[model samples]
Target: MPRFDITIVGELNLDLILYGLPESLPPERELLASRLTLTLGSSSAILAHNLAVLGSGVGFLSRIGDDALGEISLAKLAESGADVSKVRRARGSTTGLTVILARPESRHILTYPGAMFEMGFEDLDLRYLADARHFHVSSFYLHRALRHRLPEVFARMKAAGLTTSLDTNDDPDDRWDGELDQTLPSVDVLLLNAHEATRTARAANLEEALEKLSKRTPVLVVKTGAEGAIARRGREEYRTRPRAVETVDAVGAGDSFDAGFLHQFLRGADLERCIAFGSLAGAFSTTRPGGTEAFRDRAHFEEFFSHHSTAEADALPSPKPAPLQAKP
Candidate 1:
């Protein structure tokens, strides 16, 4: 049996969130925030961290700079219970960092790719990768070095008897282009938000986008904020309503959903259960200022999960799978 339930290959970074900022930033003006937080950031790291917090044995591999920020990133990941022994520290580069200006309903992020851009397929250690039953990759566009080589990597992981998932976070270039045809076939699941799904499919609407993507990906999960999420598997579709919660910050909510869905998925839960749990996890994330804060420990996770379980049960019925027929 594999030593780890899941292994994540992606970028590592720190998020410095400045809260209580003005509605707009005027040029040449110095602005101050009422609150500030530094936390583990990066799509893949958040997913792995929350997955480990949810009790999965996770292994994480990424490239970081040999610097103070990199050290903090590694320490945070270690504290989250993910195996970071395989993470590499690249020389001559600084760790990636994101400065987030947090507003009431949205956030603006400025990023420095730094050493994260140095990682490529050659940097991966397959011997360590083979010890995980599953593999996941995220922030596709940001990982410039690995963009062209991911299909081969996924194929290799599959050949080594591991299931794989991909979440190509927003493409900064807006081109929405990647090795989808070559990569999706090797990926068991493709996770994306509504806008990303529509853009990736090059379609005019959500249903059309789902139809287009479902042709390439076996399982496609599209996150629809507030309305919850929808998933397509073969000719079937599964969906759940969002678990209502007071919002604090939306950072990392999607990654938290991925973690919840995968946590239940790895345990062989049905599609309905997976979607519901994912929604619940995502809702919990918004109760805190950052991605990993809401799930800082078992007690917090359990408390939120259990409390919301009852509330959600009383509010909505269990999700059911519906047949998805292509429109003529």
Candidate 2:
């Protein structure tokens, strides 16, 4: 077996979220949605778990704080069966965290990169990467130093014949200006949302955006919420709509979708099948309050999927009266 079906190196973080409220607003009183929940989050964690659920051996490289949150993060990853031998831990830093300002079916978040910033490229030991078959990177901004070193690192992975996948969590820090402009082309599979795809491709329309993205990386998948998602690999292009169901929460929807799609894609499934799988996972996530919590491995996904017919039977309704992306 390959050292790992997929190896993910990234900036890891804990999410502190408060979401869901009930009753109509009274202006001054400020109506709050009821039913709040907290769960493990962070793009890399979501990707790793989904990969494992998809039945691939996963290895994650990251840094976490020594506090309770850090402990929880590690415990959760271990529980998910991810090999954490390469995860680095910091003694005094607080685990990187983000607070989700959420409405029942929608979400808004205030993210803080706390200790994830500690996961600089200098900490990456290539020996671990050498054994991996695929490398997925989720955080490009948490570490300033890593931004410059990305090309060299990925080049090494490429040399080892690993397929590269990247999810961009653009840093609001100084590096955002054009750092990604230089970094995106080196990847083999580029995963992103519609907005991110447009940003990277410098295009306004979806098709044009996909064309631009594919020029750099052979496969590009863009998640378009509600409208579903689109993917292009060489001459292949496919899209899928969200599963229609009443949602309970919308927190980790997108990341979960990535998990589902990557699981199928890596297995050599076709474009349409991959989009269906990923979108199904995204829709499944809406039923839960957090991203990782909603993520179930292959058995769970399979069991749930087997119950439905035509795949599209999974679209979920907005659990909250309002949508998450609309605000802020």
Candidate 3:
């Protein structure tokens, strides 16, 4: 058997979320928030952590700074039962950190790339990454050093006989043109939010974006927040409504959605079931302060899924046969 069900290559960092912050910040004034929660941040780490918690064997590889933040982030991910044995720590750089000023209905996210921008293609181990049933990449735009080589990474993963997925989180530069065109052809699944879909496709509307993006990958998933999520597999399309819950903050909801959808996906569930479970998982994330807090509570995690998942929806065939030995 392969060592992991899914392997991820991306960033690992910490999120410092401050609640009750003013909508607009004035330059000279001292602003204070009511509450604070420091937790694991970064889309890749969130998905890997939650997927492992959901019972999928996960392997994660990332480059981090040799700092306290990096250690804390690595430890947090390891606590999820993921293998972080290959995580690299660079001596001079500091780990990335995101400071979220969360207001009532909106949030301002400020990030210092730090070591996140330092990871290069040289840091990746193809054989290690390919020793899995699936491969996923997130925050495509953030991998400055490794950006150009991502297409090769995806291609090699596909050539190694492993399915692959990509979540091009957000483009801080707003230039949607990276190696995305080259990478899309090898991706079996493509995940995006409505805004990201529109932006990436350069479409005038969501409908156009969906139509255009669906053709690029075998499966296209667009996260719609409160409206739930939608998936397209060729001519067939599936959607699921959002679960009603008292939301604390939406910190890691989308990543949790990816985790849920992928967990079901690796189990050979249909798209409809994957979408529903994804929506359910997303709603559960909002009950806590950060993206991963709700998941950290074993009782809350199991209770939420047990109450939300249907027997029929939960029944999925076992994963497909593991991929062949990865080529060097």
Candidate 4:
């Protein structure tokens, strides 16, 4: 019924990913030896890029500083085929940034909220909501300024007849309070990591946390890093093992998973398949560098997915970690 399959309205960030080894967390001085990677990393931004790679007509609305960082961000989005006109260029804020200190395939972030904190319901394109099948908002915790818009956007999305979803970044102060109950009733899904699930709703365990969230939202996806992830749709539950790959940088891994899940889901794929698809995206991203940089086109994703993920509804590969997945 809608012209665009899905629309993601949120932050887009530029990541300066610093590389190192697993022995010990590298100091800033040691970064010179490890190599710093400048790449695309954003939640709604990367997911929208992955969705565009899947050939979906997507619209994204966000604000960026009118600087090289913003230009690079726009260039990355345009190359991915996501609609770019909705991205607003601002005067002072210089786009969002995450400084990632990395190991062999994993990373630790020191993020600077920058311009991402500048977004609010004031930046939205109201008509865009009416034209999309789904509307998802994510990554507000990078800054405190945007939190006020969640209720407004959720309220508007429901009134516009758009299927809504919310994904959040990890922050104790930023975790959804009772706002989720007000927000979740309109949200069709909530994409949260194990930490967020365990922390936000204050449940004793992961399953209980999901149970509590699902009572309000229609579906819940809880991702538990290396242990894998789970998805619940009403009475049905589907689980999948993460694709075993060399970890490049865990930065944006969750966003990659979200992109993978939403891409197939927009095509109306089944729950298990969607979970599998998301796992592949999540896994493949870890095998490379940067946030969005980890993702390849659909063809590359499908190939790696087929090779790593189980073919039938069998057990997941008993992963034996050895070498990293970097194509060195």
Index of the highest-TM-score prediction: 3
> Of models 1 and 4, which has the larger lDDT?
1
TM-score of 3: 0.95
Reference-based TM-score of each model: 0.93, 0.85, 0.95, 0.86
Residue 136 Cα positional deviation in candidate 2, in Å, after optimal superposition: 0.5
Better TM-score candidate (1, 4)? 1
Estimate, for each residue in 1-328, the C-alpha lDDT of model 2 and write its tens digit: 4566678887566666665544233557766645555567888887787566546677888888878888877777777778888877888778877787666455566776777766777678787876766777886766655767887787788787777778885446433454666666668777888876776677888778888778777778898877899888777888888878667666667778877776665665566776888888888777666776655444545556666435534321111111111000
Candidate 2 whole-model C-alpha lDDT, 0 to 1: 0.70
lDDT by residue for model 4 (1-328), tens: 5667778888886778766544465466442436777887777788888767756677888899988988988898888878888899989778877777776544566777777877766777889755877788887465356676677777787787777778876774654574555566667778999989877788899878878776766778889887789998877888888866787667777888887787666656677877887777787887777666644444655566556655523312112211211110
Kindly provide the TM-score of model 2 when superposed on the true structure, using C-alpha atoms.
0.85
Q: What RMSD does model 2 have?
A: 7.7
What is candidate 1's lDDT per residue for 1-328, written digit by digit as tens?
6788789998988999999999988999988899999998999899999888877778999999999999999999888889999999988889999989999767898999998788988889987887877889989888888889888889999898888889988888899876766888899889999999999999999999999998888788999887899998888899888866888888989999998888777766667777788888888888887889888855777677667767445222122212121110
Question: In candidate 1, which residue pairs get closer than 3 Å at backbone N, Cα or C atoms, i.e. clash?
Answer: none
Ranking by lDDT: 3, 1, 4, 2
The lDDT per prediction is 0.84, 0.70, 0.88, 0.73
2 or 4, greater by TM-score: 4
Model 4 residue 295 lDDT score: 49
How many clashing pairs per prediction, in order?
0, 19, 0, 3
Model 1: residues with Cα > 4 Å off, grouped in runs: 310-328
Predictions: Cα RMSD each: 5.3, 7.7, 3.0, 7.4
Candidate 1 lDDT at 124 equals 94
